[model samples]
Target: MIVAIAHSRAQLGISAPAVRIETHLTNGLPAFNLVGLPETAVRESKERVRSAILSSGFEFPSRRITVNLAPGDLPKEGTRYDLAIALGILAASGQIPHAPLGDFEAVAELALTGELRGVRGVMPAARACQQASRSLIVAPDNVLEATRVRGVQVLPAATLSALCGHLKQTQRLAWAAPAPPYAHSNLAGQPDLAEVRGQYFAKRALEIAAAGGHNILLYGPPGTGKTMLATRLAHLLAPLDDEQAYEVAAIHSIAGLHRAPGQWLVPPFRAPHHTSSAPALVGGGSTPRPGEASLAHHGILFLDELPEFGRRVLDVLREPLEIGRVTIARAAGTVDFPARFQLVAAMNPCPCGYHGDPGASCRCTPEQVRHYHSRVSGPLLDRIDIQIEVARERNWLSSTVTAQLESSASVRARALAARARQWARQGKINHHLSVSELSLHAPLDRPTEKFLAHAFEHYRLNPRTYHRLMKLARTIADVADCPAIAQDHLSEALALRRLEVAPAWPAGMKH
Candidate 1:
């Protein structure tokens, strides 16, 4: 045979797009040519494939060789195509049967010794192959990740010769067993809510945030346990469903992150440092990759020392916070990554970290405090559903105080019950309810309406803020297991909007 074809996949964002590997041998001077919009790494695969094929005891055709990755418009950028390219060359050279390549897709890197190596984004490729109703061939290193996708037939190959032997019927590769079932809940290593000494209000706000998937900001003096409170919020969250777990796993896989099998269903928690760039916070680059926001999909994204991050970097989160995805556009194309993360941020009241505390004297003028708070934009603040203050607990170290604190399991039980109510009532979480849906699910009586209107006008809330306030009230009511938004719920929701009140910082200072 002078020509042969093999199937493979390319990683684009979290998606695996099909790429056809076409190889041909012609009567001419000995040379190898690769065509398609292949990047540096993929271009280097030619040498790797040549070495791998020779090392596998296969004859290298001396005729001119040409390889093309079809759908030339889509850019190819990884070593994942090496195995398929080598297989195509062998098939075209009549060293392996080309007929058997029709039923399978391969994605793995090739070593100089003809051994197969694992590549990133195997989970996505496995899913795509399963959807296409084709079996997948991968290295032993990727077998577990590929098998994680249910119903995908994964054949683990150790070397090119072994795979060729299997294809020729001289030997057979065993199918990998399916991965173990995902655990529904994994709070084993999570910090318990009871570990936090005090800050009942902060704990309540965290509970509300987890129950309804609301974004929260916890601001206070240093050593007030804001970070501690933020870390515990993920444990209170409900486990991801099967589909969500797969989505989360695929995103992490694309980013080259792996977690223990037991933690597959547990919500992800990501805390990027203040020094992280905008692209690092939101996914972006010459070749776009999943950033921290995308990594936190179906989970929590906690930003400690929130104001310490660049203002522009923080602003980049506004879009993903509003819509549950981040769209990064480059000259090549635009990629969208799922970023439906529940944001939990911690910050001090001032640069000196003790502006409002009675125990410490103010170090700078009010302007410094205003400027520090202004680093966080108003639009960004408006998108956050709950903004509460964490205060210092003078006697929290006392044994008496620790005994009264609730455990994470207890809080998670209540939070789960609240979420169940939300799901039953509106078929979605309170945080995701649209304005129209809110009217139907969270109707308010006349008195409560009047009370909310007075507070809204008094605070000069924007439409977005008003809607978020309503969502927060609905969440509060759900936590209380109430069917309707009550006056008390509205009142508590308003109070949780710490920026809406005076003296915390001037309301005008937010802009």
Candidate 2:
């Protein structure tokens, strides 16, 4: 045979798009050519393919060789194509039959010794191959990740010679077994809520946030346990469902992150440093990799020392917070990554970390405090559903009165019940409810409506704040297992909007 074709996939964002590997051999001077807009890594695959074929005891054709990755305009990158290119060359040279290549898709890097090596983003390729109804061939190291996609036939190949033997019907590669059924015991361990000392109000706000998938900001003095409260919020939330787990796993795979066994179902908790750049926070680069926001999909993104981050860096998250996705456009193309993360942020009240504390004397002038608060933008504050203060626990160590605090399991039970109600009523969490859906699911009675309107008018709340307050109220009511939004629910929701209040030192700080 003078020509042969093999199938493969290319990673774009979290998606795997099909790429056809076509190889042709002609009677001419011995030379090799590769086309189709391949990037540096892919272009280097030619040498790796040549070495692998020779090392595998296969004849290398001396005729002129040409390889093309079809759909020429689509840019391809990575070493994933090495295996496919080698298989194509062997088939075209009559070393392996070309007929068996049609039923399978190959995605693996080839070593100089003809061994197969795992590549990043194999989970997405496995899913795409499953959808296309084709079996997937991958290295043994990647067998577990590929088998995670249910119903996908994964054939693990340790070396090029082994795979060729399978293709020639002389040897058969065993199908990889599917992953075991997920159990509740396999959930990732998290710090218990009981570990935190006092601050019942902060705990309450965390419960409400977890119940409705709402974004929360905890602001107080330096030693007030704001970070502690933010970290415990994820544990109060339910575990990810199968589809959500798969999505999270695929995103992690694309980012070259590996989760320990039994951690797949756990919601991700990403805490990026305050010095992280905008692209690091929102997922951008020349190649457009998944950023921290996308890494936190279906989970919590906790930003400690929130104001310490650059204003522009924080602003880059506004669009993803509103739309549940981040769209990064580069010179080549635009890529969208799922960024539906539950934001949990922690910050101090002022530059000195004690603006309103009665215990500490004010060290800075009001201007410094004002400037510190202004670093966080108003629009970004508006998108946060809950903003509560974590006051210092006075005489925390002096008093030894031991009393059992609420545990994470009990709080999670309540949170799960509330989420169940939300899913049954609207097929989504309260924070994701649309304005129209709010009218139907979160209706207010006459007196409650009047109370909410009076609060809105008094606070000069914008439409976005008003709607978010309604969602918060709906979540509070759900946690209480109430069918309707009561006046007290609205009152508590309004109280949680601490940033909306104008303080003396931090003047002009209003959501």
Candidate 3:
């Protein structure tokens, strides 16, 4: 009897869990069996592995061969285990020594002709291997991605024969150096604020939203440039730092975005259509992959035509809005994905898309208008920090002084300055400040407090809404470079709350 062991990683959401492959060969009928709760892809690798071994000119053991992946209930998936299994079989059959394989963790798929193929989602596994101080052996195709990590030894193998030769000291593998970091794109090329032609007040709201990391909602007539505002907002936000860039890129790599690792410094932007289901928005499946929300981690999630989305689908965002992460539960286990993304949703005032238009006449009755607005619930709206009504620009094309309008670069500068102040003072963005943290960081003067109280009573504001209003005022103060929350700042913040009450229908409305 002979036994050989090797190690690799298994895909579990955005995580990489260690898996051990133990191979045993004994004198019995020539039968091969793989045990350990492997999914279909893993089970099918048996045929691929045997073919690869024979094609690589390695001896195939004829005795009973039983391979067990340790921790039987982990439920392994994918063909990432194939390379480890092949190496294990070679070791157990005395074709290769075991001591040489101890320092490295390998993962790759095997072609029937013995070539090593790249597998998806290798970033997280590479990160795990680096953290554990183990060398990582990857297929030549995956070497580009594996080089994203530093301080870890990464080697590329082209086929089973090449890997066996390296293990037997008959050949040498070249070490992969970390790739150079990519520079951020020029912010000037981004959509400029001047392109919108008008809506200066809405532009101010976007600035505040970017400054404080706040979620916003835009409601207006069709062709009012709501979607354009969301896109420009992406440019105004700050680029991801090194740590955040790695995290965001890691998520994308797992999702198979396959962007060159260095070029992902810009924040991500995800715009899911209204017809998307809850699983596609918030994430769900037997193996629970990240949805659009998590895919936009540390960036932006824009949902245009918000009212057209199903009420249930829109409501799924409530959890991630309150918490920075989403927990997806499955029979296998629960996995959490980062979802600290700013939401920017847009919708028409009513089904007609012009219920309150100045130029166009309304054709829909009050009931229909109310029903269209009712698709988005009040609680969800309350979670949004800023709400603005985007008015239709009468001189959208006629206005000729667009060159004087502020560019995205200028607005982004102001937003970044404000964000810098908040980070310097409180160590976080204003929107993330807790109640106690706000009290310590943003204190209201007596007169400002009185003004806020009156507005709270008049608007029937909930506790959360009132606090968010305070946070908004704090952010506005930061943008204006004010040292205190003055009455003017509070008043401006109050005026920016555009959705206090849903518009009354043309017909006499009923509560």
Candidate 4:
């Protein structure tokens, strides 16, 4: 008899529907075959499944066993299908009953000893099972992530024997429940805002950036603590809500980064290297996986040494930054991943890395400086909301200016209050405000209106830049604890836009 069990595979994002797993036994050449668009990882799972079943004391039937992951046209990837395939084979060979397995979705990896190892994207898989009104069975290691999805029965198994025992009614597995202490308190080695000295303007900009979910560009000479400030900004963000935490954990789980059995309540901070490829940064392959941007959803993606990144790689971010999602199309199918990330990039003024520093002389020629600046396209720069130059502190490395700075806890308190105000008034963050909505929410005063009109034509700002200006203004208002946008807010907003002022290029020229 042929045995088929239902399981799922994550394509681009966690919320997508799952691929159906079908196992069939046919009398043929006693060969094992996998159909559907299986990637290299899925194909390799056949070996692991076989080894796991034999090691777990199950007989490998000497019949033609064909495993099919349907929809046959959709591409399947990763080690997530190992346990599902093993279970399907066991059921097909009459070693395990198919009755208990039919009502649940099972996903896990298997070791040679039949130990059920955790696979990536288990959270999303559990969510899909719950939405389809089926119970979710996952590896014991993935129980923490799967439990994040509420209203779902999460059955965690540590080994193949445990799973078989549960299915055969010999023993019952404990159902996964919501993890208590949703807010994370332990920030191991997390940077603190209090440690940063001076640069109050930069600190304020960081605060505003956190408040509005805006992208920030910190351009200055080296050793100005740009990276240090960016690292600490995550601490100021409000803890992720239960739903958002689940989404984040799912992405981390799918990316194989969620190894611990606890909550990931804090916002994620992903700082990819400058040399990261477009695929790794944006996510693409034969079988699609979430990239750095997708993993950083509802969080921060910090790119230090921004200009050093490949021009093409940097350019790939424009689409996801604007739309809050990334889609990868292959011959098998197209998959979309959520990429609503706050871009926090930092760089020096020029290749010599001291173009604007008062403490150090710039070694680069004018042409070299211009070329270095040109590496970052004007279009990408326009998307950034806060652009501020940080000058090196006067005391080189010796002076210790000791004044109490606001703690991240206090800053986060203010930030959440500000965020609540914005959400209450506009139904979203300032960065998401539409043009007509901005006219009402961030209504410029007479003088500010005139300034923007003149600046738009004189500076030849694009519509996106125009909207970014208003968004920055709204953020400024939010930081000031003001109910309405004010002239000072508009002025502060324009100040940040001055980072776009650089050596002029010809019309239509981009990075």
Candidate 5:
């Protein structure tokens, strides 16, 4: 007899349609064989299936049993196939009826005593099952995560025996309804923007960055609240919509970092340490997974102490920053992860941290200062849309002033209004606008056009940097509620770009 059960495996960014698990009893020496390019985890599921069958008081067939994961060309990984394999063997041996197994997509990792364990990427698997119009049988531990996807009949199984009992009509498992997703509130653990004591210029730049989904770089001496301000940017972002929530949650579940009992509603804030490797920051493994950048998708990626990281590691992010996705090609195949994130990086002016500080004198030589700043490549700096220098002032922090600054909630309200206006004017946000779209929507007025032409010649700006400056100016215009980008907007945008001018190369080194 041969018994086949249906399952699924995630490939690239989506779940492949279906993988049928078939167990056949054939005449040969007593041994078990698994086929269909099963990875080590899938192959190892055999021992677990055997132990679980016997420990659950089911007979293990003595004949040579060959288990084949159908659609043989498809590469299968993970312990997700354990339950399907076990059920196929049981139904082949005629212990459990095959009719019930045919209706549901069974996915779980089984222990020797038949206890079902949780598996990764359950959210995506559940969604796939729903799309296929099939029921999902998940381990009790995974039910919490799986229930995040609605419109699916979720049967949470405690153990393999429990599933068998239910399928055989001896007992039944309870159905789990979808869990309501939770939204992150500005009043929660988040710090308010009003708490930032000073640096109004930096605060305004933060507003523009959040409004346009632009990347920002803050260069200043130590203790200027660059890190402090970056942390509050998420609070300024509007809450994720339902579809965006599920997308973010699904990525987190696959990464095994989903928050318990609730979903992430607000944009996620990921601050990977400077010591993170290229793989850890960008994401890769034997089985490629979402890295920090992808995990920060639809959210913020904050890098403090920017120049301290490996130049190569920082360089790895340039491609994703441009394309909004990261592709990791392996022997298995190519897996692409979403890398659309707003980047906020902070750095010191020099190695000694006092190059331009009004509060202190610099010790580093000119060459040393140049080397320290040069660690950040020109190409990377060009990608950053807004750049600002934070100069220290103690008056804002003094006891005499008690006036309140705008809270994150207030700032977010203005930001949402600005975003709605921009999106309505252009189909997408300002940051996503292409060159053609920019020409149509942000056509510069005569005065602004003349100002940009003069600045381009004086500052020696490249075409890429010119586009970035115009985009930033468009964002500023959006926030100002102006019908057309004006000369002041272009002037302000150019001021930000000129804040940190890269060192001029030696006479012969100019490209």
Candidate 6:
């Protein structure tokens, strides 16, 4: 009797937990039994591993070989364990030395022809290997992504035979070096604010949102450049720091998203269509995968035509917005994925395309308009820090250029400076500050305090709304380079908070 063990990882949400593959051989009827809660893909690895070993010029021991994934309670899934299982068989059969096998971890899918296939969602495993301080063995195709984890020793093998030769201490494989850090240029080629004809107010709102990572809602009639403004928000923001870049890349990699190499450094901007289902928006499946929000972690989640999305679908954002994480639960268990995304949503003024437009008349009735806006519940709207209307630019065609209307480059520099101030003061952006932290960090003087109190009472503001308003004012102060919340900052934040305050959404609807 002989026993062998190899290390692998099991995919759970965005996490990859260590899995031990134990293979044993005994004197009994020729049989191969795999245990320990393996799903379809893992169970099928038996034939794949056997064929790969035999095709690679290794003897397939015809014994009652039993394989077990330890911690039988943990569900095993995917073909990522194929290489680990094959190596276990060889080490147990005396075809390869067993001692060195314990020094490394492996993740690869095996081809029947003895070639190695790259496994999806191996980035988490690569990180786990690095954290565990273990050298990771992967296919040549995966070396690029595996090396994304800086300082993790990696060996890329083209075939099982190649890997076996190296493991035998006969022909050692060359280890992979980490790829160079991706270089990112400051928002140079992206769309510029100067391209947009006018709407200085909307541009200012965007600048505040970018500086503080606050969620914003843009409401107006058609042709107001709402979508255009929302798309350019990414340009006004800072590039992802090293930690943020890794998190974004890891999330995308786990979702099996195809990313061209340097693109990972740029902040992700995901704008899902209104017709997407709730599960698609919030991330739901039998096995539970990441949704658009998780994919937008450390980035932007833009939803255009906001009211067109179902109320139920929109409601899924309530938790992730407040907690900065999304939890998907199935009969299997619950898995949480990071969802700290800045939301930028745009909606029409009413059911009719041109409800509030001075040039175009609205046909939507009062009831129809109410029903349309009702699609976005009050709770969800409350979570949004800035809710401002984007009015149609009437004079853009004939308007003169002014110094106040700067390019996105100028706005981006201001936004970055504001963000630097926030980070230096609180170690985080204004939006993430807790209620206590917001109170302590954003101190209002006697006059500003009285103004906010009077406004809150006038609006019948809820506690959440009041706190969000303060945070918004704090961001406004940050933008102005003010150390404390000023009266002007409070006034501007108050003006932006009202959803229908700016001439209403198509201000009046006929009953």
- Quote each prediction's TM-score: 0.96, 0.95, 0.94, 0.88, 0.95, 0.94
Clashing pairs in 4: 121-254
lDDT of 1 by residue, 1-511 (tens): 2889999998888899999999999998998888885557656898899999999999888989999898888867758999999999999999999998989999999998999999888999999999999999999999888999999999999999999999999998898999988877867667999889878889889888888989999988888889888998989988888899999999988887886688898999999999999999998877778999999999999999988999999999998998989999988788899999999999988888888788998796788888888888888877788888888879999888888778999999999999999999889999999999998888889999999888878877765677888899999999999988999998889888887664556444454
Which one wins on TM-score?
A: 1
Query: What clash count goes with each model?
Result: 0, 0, 0, 1, 0, 0
User: Cα deviation in Å at residue 53, candidate 2?
Assistant: 1.3
What is candidate 6's lDDT per residue for 266-290, written digit by digit as tens?
Answer: 8888998899998887787876778
Give the Cα error of residue 460 in candidate 1, in Å: 4.4
> Per-residue CA lDDT of candidate 3, range 120-139, in tens?
77888898999988888898
Q: Write the per-residue lDDT of candidate 5 for residues 1-511, one digit (tens) a residue.
A: 5655646554445343478887888777888888885557655787888899999889998888888887876656757788888888888778899887778897788887899988777888888888888899988888888887878779998888888899899997789977874645445556888888878888888898888888998878898888999898888887887777777777788787775543367788899999999999888987778888888888999999999988889998998899988998778677888888999999888888888676799998888877777778777777888888776877887765437777888788778888998889987889999999999999987777998898888767766777888888898898899979998898888766645334432111112
Clashing pairs for predicted structure model 1, backbone only: none
What candidate 4 gets wrong by more than 4 Å, as runs, is: 1-12, 16-34, 37-46, 63-67, 171-178, 184-189, 259-263, 395-401, 451-464, 500-511
RMSD in Å for model 5: 2.5
Which scores better on lDDT, 2 or 5? 2
**Which has the higher lDDT value, candidate number 2 or candidate number 3?**
2
Looking at model 1, how many pairs of residues clash? Answer: 0
For model 1, give the RMSD to the true fold: 1.6
- Output the lDDT of residue 72, model 3: 81
Stretches off by above 4 angstroms in model 6 are 402-405, 457-464, 500-511
Residue 82, candidate 1: Cα error in Å is 0.5
Candidate 6 yields a Cα-based lDDT of 0.84
